[model samples]
Target: MRNFLIDSLGLAGFGAMNYGLYLKFGLADALISAGGLLLLLALAGARAAKRRNESKGAA
Candidate 1:
């Protein structure tokens, strides 16, 4: 479901950032991972919002 995707993607993104930091990866690399995660989260939110709008329109 949508919830599962959001949760898993968010956690994976955070984990990637943390792992990068722990391994002494540079800021640029960390930022890249973080940006990717942000994009995923944004897309998920948009999908949920669109579904909500459609449901309301149907009612």
Candidate 2:
């Protein structure tokens, strides 16, 4: 599930970058968006890890 979430985020990010490129957006805008997506992916991974740990502790 965690891997799936990360993969989905990556795909979305790529699509977003492509769209920005297609629209001829500025480099700074694309870089900022990429950074935002990376942050989101890291957060999602951390959340998933926390949940997994909780379940292990409960078990």
Worst 10 residues of 2 by lDDT: 18-27
- List, residue by residue over 1-59, the lDDT tens digit for candidate 2: 99999989979879877677647877777777778877998999899999999999999
lDDT by residue (tens digit), candidate 1, 1-59: 99999989978878876677757987777778778878988999899999999999999
C-alpha TM-score for every candidate: 0.62, 0.65
* Best-matching candidate per TM-score: 2
Clash pairs detected, candidate 2 = none
For model 1, what is the C-alpha lDDT against the true structure? 0.84
